[model samples]
Target: MKKIITKELVPGMVLADAVLTPKSNILFEKGTILTQKDIAKLTFYSIDEVLVHDNEIGEIMTISSLPDGQITASERIKQTKEFQIFKADFEKCAEKFKNEISDLVAGNKEFDYKRLLAPIYELLQKGQTNSAVFEMLNNLRNYDDATYTHCINVALASNILAQWLRWSKEEIETATLSGLFHDIGKLAIPEDIITKPGKLTSSEYSIVKTHPQKGFDVLKNVTISIHVKNAALMHHERCDGTGYPGGLKAPQIDRYAKLVSITDVYDAMTSARYYRAPLCPFIAISMFEEDLQKYDTEMMLCFLENIVNTYMLNTVLLNTGEVGEIVFINRNYLSRPTIKIKNDYIDLSKCPGVYIQEIL
Candidate 1:
């Protein structure tokens, strides 16, 4: 079986795995052939791509990285190293505008074009890594100020989510920058409010709510595109009209803003915060699944499906202390799946005697 990106999906590919949504699960039954219409339907579900099994996995050409289900943590670590190097090179681009606040203020001038181009070149030069960059960012949280790191982490998560939705390369880049600076206005807020380490007062919360507008004001003079500014301003807006700044609903919100909103919530819930300990990925995914109506259903499905498939190759130890590689996922119960030991298969879904304790 080979994984293909949605852009590369074509007719006549047989699904090697099942496709799922927040409300339903559709297993294509291993050998089922996919027609163009079937492919189109899957695309409507925000499926970036599907794994098709043939004599062997065939390559599907795509400008963006294809989602491969068979990626390992070690491989993710390698990708993280590559990103670190890219970040180091990219930071240099910010040097030219060091003394120019206007250049920095202008969203366009702040980004290092060379650095922006490096990662894509590297991704092409090397092969696409199976996992998204967010997984790596999640592991890098030992820095002093957690808020800034959290913002960066949220941005990475948002960009990965947007990429999974098969947005154009230009849109993906703009979304990424927007995610990175969505909270720039927070820079102007009082530090005490930003890091209160306790419940915020209604007055303080009001101040916090002004971040979107403040961020837009800060970048108003910058050369950054309107999409980026909107992302910063509208990320906090929710579909239920419960979000801050502007209570925009469904069609009123920008696509990028919606994407950032989901990513922001996921990162915040899964990270250690002043109010609570971090939630595990499985739990976080479940929570997101429960609230799918609050987001673009298709995008939410894509995010959940990608995350489940991405971690399948990692080594995990069951509650029974049995260690093995995740070789198969049960469509009905994603949290539990079949594991492959030395020479046998342990279907956690069917094996009532055993269970997964934790992922190592």
Candidate 2:
């Protein structure tokens, strides 16, 4: 199963998913083969893409890249046209903080706490602005350096969650600070261990688990609130008491720590790593659902409903050699949704024999 853009739509190709409108109504169904007339009608909907299962070719069709000559000056300008200026400013702050992370871990006597908190202050000017900035940075252009980029991404996501939870202005600032510095302890660990392309040995894993305590020790003397300190110390702890450093369970771990933990796992799962390719957001969400016991149920639900909803729309795909668009979502069971292809409706919740084999 695969996804192909509208330009690739052709007669005889089956839909793996369903095509849906914003109103949650099906436009087509799974297993419905495309026709020339159907393709012509799709343009009216402003749909630029569709997922199709091409059994004859043995793959799903997808638009791989932007078209040639499409990278105009206007396009580049649009890229920099931020929906929220504060978010852009916050990213600059994150970048500056990243520069001193190594020095903090090396026990530098000159590390400055006020300077470290500057980004957090900038991120809290307005909750809505901060949230917009967080979203913008999450979709920011990638850099070759994965560690720095991953850290920033995690910080942005964590900050958004904190804002959504309606933490006090002061608490939101501390949460952002904690998230930005949560992985600072990694600097004390060997670079080889941090960037190893293979699985870690048991001894290496033990060293890796020491990051939380290491981060806490580095910030112990720093002039910051206790909320910030605790978040850094317990971001790796789980609700199920199955996480590392200290296996503190629910209630034992602070709410801020739990919030950071969820964001940490989400960023790690979605970012490309030395050992594996980045997982798709949908797949990562599913994985989190399966491990719901490991996180705060209310927070996890908020993250999914509020944050993820923005990205889950109009996604086309193939399911078991058929192509379709997602017409509706089953919040309780995200894996099974109503899909529309050409002219059919697939009620996955009722179709025991059908399954989504791939994401186009």
Candidate 3:
């Protein structure tokens, strides 16, 4: 299969993989012949590229006529092995980051942004799309207290959001680095408090709130941009003047800080914590919608749109205890999307009380 940009998609091209809606709905199935409607949907979803059979582009090759049931055993094994390798590499990189962060906290030394940011830059450049990173993030959410991995996830998310906003590549890179250093101060906090399984006392919570300031102190002197330093200090500050440390309002908050702040909350909310299980991405979107005033609305909107689209074509469990694939998304009501369960299509906008429970 060859990957091609959305514009290259034309009628009669066979899909090598399913196309999904932003709501995790499968807009088109693999091996289905494309049509004008399908191309329009792909454009609407802002999909960058899709995998198509080389034969569809005029390359001659033997076609497999095997019946499509569940994935073949060999295909499943290949996917499993690929996931294992991805997970292993991610953990190893995170471990190196943990040690580097430790050194920064212990000796009060300059951060090696070159070394720390290398992996993220490479991942972004290599993948050149959200699919790979999104898959890794979904898997990472199952683990606990992976600080380095969380940082990387936030960085990637910030970059994606910035790119979606049509920001300059330089700005995106800065936003990415800002996210990486946003939690640097957490390294100074006591591990017991950081990973406490129960609710924290006010004093303990107060300690936790000091991370932004501590993080700023650590990064302030580093040979990075002022935006990066301020982002670390102000990521916790809210738009309505209700955040920690300085409690700076929206006008007072740095733009870079604003971007990192969204991703910071996103990664934290989606990741499993000692105190609670991870929330579904849909829940996170709901929270963002409800608290839209607390964040930069434009940034949040871009993030919501792009992030949800990454789940397109994914299998999900519904609140009604049925399994389905997302089939359509109502732009006005992003959280409620039409789902396809076998032959039945469930339009969530029309069916109250039916909601997505989890992405499988």
Note the Cα lDDT for every prediction shown: 0.64, 0.66, 0.75
Best by TM-score: 3
Predictions ranked by lDDT, top down? 3, 2, 1
What lDDT does candidate 1 reach at residue 340?
92
lDDT of 1 by residue, 1-360 (tens): 788775466545767887765467763456656643345445435466677775542333222221367554545665666666644533342332232323444444454533443443343233244364555444543324345555555656666777788988888777777776677778678889998865567899799999999888887766677877888889888887767788888789888888888888777766665433354465566556556677877777787778778778767666455668889877656666789988999887687545553344
The numbered model that scores best in lDDT is 3
Q: Give the per-residue lDDT of model 3 (tens digit) for 129-229.
A: 66666656666566556667788788888888888899997898899889887898888899889877654678998999899888888876778889989
| Model 2 alpha-carbon drift over 4 Å, by segment | 1-94, 108-114, 117-138, 141-145, 319-327, 334-337, 342-360
Clash pairs for candidate 3: 22-309, 25-326, 25-327, 26-326
List, residue by residue over 1-360, the lDDT tens digit for candidate 2. 787776566656777889875566787787767643345435434466777776733233343333365452223433664534644675576677767876776777467766766665555543346445544544443434355566666666777787778778777766777677778777778899988765567899799889888878888887677766787789989999987778999989987788888888878765554423344455566667767999999989878766445434334444355666677777776656777867887877688545443334
What's each prediction's TM-score? Answer: 0.62, 0.68, 0.75
Better of 2 and 3 by lDDT: 3
